[model samples]
Target: MRAAVVISPLASAVLAGCVVSQTQGGAEHLAAPDGAVYEGVDTRLLDGELVNFVVAMRGARGPDDVTAYAECAAAQYALIRGYGFARQVRTTVDEKNGAWTGDAVYTISPALPRGTRTIDAEVVVAACRENGIPTV
Candidate 1:
């Protein structure tokens, strides 16, 4: 002789909920394949010819995306200030709650700055616009 076991409908529903909830609140669920979503840029003049840019975004693949956003802002800011070039000083990137932020600094000059990371303001701004990154 054999005994048969049965699960009630209510118990089955509770078991299903437990399995589904295990995959929630993970980084993979927050990431998007369509690419990063640019948020905004904030440019501040720290000193004469020295500018600081704070940029934020979502769905960034890594720190590179955040850095690029900050660089784009610095380039546009240089042009707005009547400068033709900018040299990257440094950039600090951070991620929290699936949002990325970059704090970058650059020096603007009318002449091409003496650095390997120098950027032509006009060229950078054009690229930024093409790439759909916001600038200040």
Candidate 2:
């Protein structure tokens, strides 16, 4: 009976390990593909009246297939603008180590004239679909 108990615990531990390993492996595999990750958002005011917005994102892709990364960056910017928070957007994308990092900036004005407010936006990043399905 003691041997049976020991075996059961050992089996459970092995199963747990397998599960963990698979989960981590899956994440790594997913991250390996050319894609992007939304880091965070920052907002500020320019000239005390013009609202400024900045979104931070990271993307990765190979040399030949940069279109995916570009699309990803555009999607990120559009997603934020869709929220109706900013008036206009100025975006910048940087690529490094087979990865692309992007920053999107915009502006928001308050109701009162001469009043500027900066809003830091946060967005979730997900993998693009094969059929061009919206991931946001």
Best by lDDT: 1
lDDT by residue (tens digit), candidate 1, 1-136: 7433322111222334421111221111111225778888887889999998998899887776677677778878888889988888888989999999989999999987775567777766665565566678
Worst 10 residues of 1 by lDDT: 19-28
**C-alpha local distance difference test of each model:** 0.67, 0.32
**lDDT of each residue in 19-54, candidate 2, tens digit only:** 111221111122224355555445454554333344
Best by TM-score: 1
**lDDT of model 1 at position 51:** 90
Task: Give residue 38's lDDT in candidate 2 (0 to 100).
Answer: 50
Clashing pairs in 1: none
